[model samples]
Target: MMKKLFSLSCLPLVLVLLSGFMGLQLAEARLHYNYHPKMLFVFGDSYVDTGNTRIDQPGSWKQPYGITFPGKPAGRFSNGRVLTDYIAKYLGLKSPLPYKFRKLIPQQLKYGMNFAYGGTGVFDTSSKNPNMTIQIDFLNQLIKENVYTTSDLYNSVAHVSVAGNDYNFYLSRNGSIEGFPSFIGSVVNQTAINLVRIQKLGVRKIVVGGLQPLGCLPGNTASSSFQKCNSTFNDLVLLHNNLLNQAVTKLNRQSKDNSTFVVVDLYDSFMSVLNHPSTNNIKEPFKPCCVGVGREYNCGSVENNVNKYTVCESPTSAFFWDLLHPSQAGWHAVYNKLQTTNAFQQIRY
Candidate 1:
């Protein structure tokens, strides 16, 4: 009887070990995608921001923000790495250093820099920082100052993550819903200029993102009890994505390298993960695993100098970390979808 019991215990252990090994193998296989980039230079907003926000901003110097990362808040908006980190890892490169921090560590400039700032848009949003045009202008200045030589620009990869900060600003200022289409047009027009500007700045390859399902974000879904997505907002997101696709197509056509400008389809990826959570092993696809109790707080927010937000036991099971941002697991799922598509593939040189 004792011998039989020991055999059963050993069997379970063996199976568990085998399963873990198999999972590691699968992850390794996925990492083997035929893609590589010399350097990844990122711009735009919080989604791809690797700590470019000013110190005064709530996200840059907050707690619970980096609890899962380097054990302290390192300026990333999410619990851990964001979309850009995963994308850089996928391309076999380290997450590029933020432009703000780059000045402090000049050696990091060789790996490329992240010029993305949270809450800023192609045009100015609420953030009191450089807009997209000014962000590019900063890079232009860096080049003129010889911070990055022409060779670095020619061999580097550029990524822009202009989420809908402009939309949020419009909504906050009570911009009429009737003006939505025109606003979107202006956003895309400026985005196109930014893309062209980066290419002209000597960056060889570029990738821009289509907006995610803003309506399904934890913030938007909160009013609906997280049971239903706001389709109206999703419709607006689709319109924006459609315009972005057209712009990328046109930009590629006019570029000298004859290389395509890629669009990271965050919209489709978010929808896919939300609609098919089972496939991604996500238990809460819309509801944030971390949330504040009342309207006066948010993920990582503190009330009365205490942690107002409650964190789920397992962040990997949750799709959202906060109202506007995704959990690290959520970004992992989206990155998986992006890897399966040719968009990310085409950007690899």
Candidate 2:
């Protein structure tokens, strides 16, 4: 009976009911009214990245990554779009250009700039990519060069994604599980600081994504044969999101006039689709569609002129794209669910 209650296949009745309520309340509580932004500024990790990482490296730049959307690799970690593209679409704007492409397409900067790099976190991780703070520093430098005018900042929305790389880094360094909660607090606190710093830089609205269900990610779920989410890991995720929500609420009260802070509840959005994939036309929720040929190789690995990974016949039917990221269709499903909730209310346009 206890096992049945925790089974993700049926999606425990308690969680099924909570997802709906949390979506509505979290959005409404954090949003500000009657504001429309003409541009967007993105920061943080891969979930919102549209290819800021180095092309020479083996990542989004490799083949089969962007096959679904661009007919080839275009640097998005997914087989196509990601959260940033979907959010930009919702705002009726083209997806923002990556900071790396700013020199190549100077005129397109008005749409916005993406400073997010895959594998980065609020703190430094195994990836040498710039951390969230450094990403914002790049924006600040651009703003000083007058590349972005006061009007641009005033009319823009900032989207921040801090996924879970910090925790991954912590564990890799052998951070004890008993000490994890306190570490979670530090992550949330630093995240709140990042949000406030972005707000201070003159963005009218800022939306920081709450951490997704880490236990349900393919890297973790693989242990359960993709059949169950580790309840222990998920409990800590809830703690992270709850603390983030509180931090956002406090920022809304303390921020400048019209500088709104909202926490986008990606957790609920992802969980809703994972729990009910048929609703979104997805077949497998936890199992990734692309994987390495062996334990050491990853979705994009290649060796000695040979491909070291296998991609699905149709990526659109899969929820997860690789061990760590979602497929383009997976993001689309999450976005569709997001629209039903009140989360985007702050973006009036």
Candidate 3:
């Protein structure tokens, strides 16, 4: 886990002063804010994980995971594309190859690599997978090997998704709710450090995802019969996003390129879609399209060769794919929401 480096109150005063001078401004020329990014580098958990967790993540490689996209199971946690693929689409590039599979397809190296593994967080989780720090170490190793020179990263953008794995891991360990705000502070503080490290390595820009409404996740909402969200948990998510936004803003000011660090407010984007499900043609915004037959099972769970999970008739009609991830269509809807946010404009031409 990322060390609880400092409190959220430490959000530098200098960033607040520079915010007006550096952030995207309508008065600035269009060309100044737009660039043709050649590649994408990804970090964090399943939300942005394309296919990096195959070995440790058996469930994702099982049937019904990639059925929505490749017509069969792949390493993607969703039935189809998740946040990574949609971000690639928005940038007009193919989803970056998985770091685990980079050796098999060296030709695709130009596009970039995904270091994210499912079930991982900025810190180590129960999965024992590489945390965000280790993920960056992989990139550092490649750079040292001269596989990716500074030029390769100069025209590239990075996407970091913090999809609440850390918090989930915390809860699973029986961490108290009263201590969550302190932990959230550490997550955002470490995230800022990660952004700075990536920028220093030559990535032109870094887009960090904010925490979504944890109260609305299927895992949390299952108790409410999918009828409503738990406001208490969601309020904590707001705290996370607030601190994350502050960190990103400060990171932008400290970057070599002004506004190099940007944030995609997943909280607002998710809440908007959930609040108006029909606007995105979602019939069940709170429930998942894929679910376990019993609490012990999950989306792709199997026992004695018999399927232990159920899939909805139409995934597109549902907002969630499993308890923790979104369906492909769900991600597309979220991506559309990003287009309308100022933070999204930094990475999109």
Candidate 4:
């Protein structure tokens, strides 16, 4: 009877092991099933820009910027791949080719096109190029020209990264804080219009990103010795995010699938990683890894060959890359937080 009981126990163990194996197989199948989006169309500014800027453009065509990437300035604004590259990798696709270089790299045409430009916004920008509306118009013109088919759009994902250039433009023009809300209204209205245009163009899943914490960017925090975030600027970001949330809900109702639109919360993700610094290896959580010697200089280049900037010995140990962008490591950490949220995960399908 003791031996019989032992055999029965062993039988249950064998059944349990078999069930675990089957569960693993089912999960793998689900991952593959959900990873079906074949293309990625990008819009907005530098956060998602994969080298859409001109070779003469100071932002992309510089050394030290891509020094960590392909050992050269490969058009990304960081030491390596930016947020959009990782998002494409997560979706099982290659980084979409820059819309500017689509003619040069025709093979990348298959993955989809990137319409984002560094330093540009929904409205006219300090950068001398088409704005967000013009970027979308380019894609629409491509569709009219038959560069991409409806099937491609239906099976694709789109990323829009409007990381507060509109507000920057407002401030640059000396627009008062009292007028900020109206400016935000204009930004969100145009953004919503852009979302609808992409959906109408037949794209199935669109992810519009929330602005990262502007107050935490080294540009805004430098005055505080990088010790504190400017809460005033952050407040405006919150307002933008609230409006974006409403816009996404409205667009989903209008699209073919209830899943037509999503928001990638860069604000919370940046704050989460900053609030809870990675337990291992990062040396500076808030300070930029790469920065110039003075306010007038930038991360990638020097003025009159004076070598005006400095880069940390290890880029991965820092969060901000320069005054405005995140390091490759910084983006990786933020991506981790983003993946934890359901908003981004649902876009995988």
List all candidate RMSDs to the true structure.
13.6, 13.9, 12.2, 6.4
What are the per-residue Cα lDDT tens digits for candidate 2 across 68-149? 9887888899999999999999887889999999999998998999999988898888456999999999999999999998
Model 1, CA-based lDDT: 0.84
Candidate 1 C-alpha lDDT tens digits along 1-349: 9999999989989999999999999888777444455688888988888887877677645877877776678888788879889878876788888998876888777778898888889988855777888889889998999988888888789999988999998888885567898889999999999999898898888889999999999888988889779898899999999999998888888877666478889999999999998799899988888787788776767767888778889877788888889878889988888888877777775
Model 4: ten consecutive residues of lowest lDDT: 276-285
In candidate 3, stretches whose alpha carbon ends up further than 4 angstroms from where it belongs are: 1-34, 55-58
TM-score of 3: 0.89
Residue pairs with backbone atoms closer than 3 Å in model 1 (clashes): none
Q: lDDT value for candidate 4?
A: 0.86
Report the alpha-carbon TM-score of model 1 versus the true structure: 0.87
Point to the candidate with the largest TM-score.
Answer: 3
After superposing all C-alphas onto the true structure, candidate 2 shows an RMSD in angstroms of 13.9
